[model samples]
Target: MPKAGRRRSAVWACFTENTASGKRRVLCLFCHHDLVANPIRMVRHIVRQCPNADEHHKKICREYQALTVPARRRPVVGGQATEAAKSADALELESARVHSDASAPPTE
Candidate 1:
């Protein structure tokens, strides 16, 4: 058991195939879709699979991303995510998407 003031880590490795090299990639907890690795992968995932992803999982991912550095920086796991965090995450994600689309370059 961990002592008081000390916490457990939530990071887990998810093995995925690298798009370019066809090699195995080990992903950390923070990078669920690997958008950080290759921006194009982020676009593809958002287009094809993410739309069909379960709502609950999407909520969790949003909450995890929107979580502030200080709050999430502390390692912990298995506890309920804060409702405030969930709501904030949803709003932030929506805003970000809107801004991104608005600023994107147009193609002929």
Candidate 2:
């Protein structure tokens, strides 16, 4: 079947069973973390694993980070370009709702 979106992290696969409301769950083949039915969150979880994650999980994370060519989703403000910085800035803006929030984005 044709893919809906770009290929996700190599460490995880989506299983489409056991859904009360007919929703699939993305399972991490590495560290088993239960993320909601959101692909972006799944990717974030894989990329930003806990500090004490197992060596295997860390190795997979590093490999994926090196392999994937990240696109510039948000405009670069300062020289430092990192997800942590973006999330921090996002948190600072009380007016800005999270991506996970179902509400529509604030109109400019």
Highest-lDDT candidate: 2
Number of clashing pairs per prediction, in order: 0, 0
* True-structure lDDT of candidate 1: 0.45
Cα lDDT of model 2 by residue, 2-104, tens digit: 9799765545542222355456664455444455656455545666754435666556656665656465576555785555446766666644555435586
lDDT of each: 0.45, 0.55
Tell me the TM-score of model 2: 0.36
Clashing pairs in 1: none
Q: Residue 20 error for model 1, in Å?
A: 6.0
Error of 1 at 99 (Å): 38
Which residue pairs does candidate 2 place in steric collision? none
**Ten-residue region with minimum lDDT total, candidate 2:** 12-21
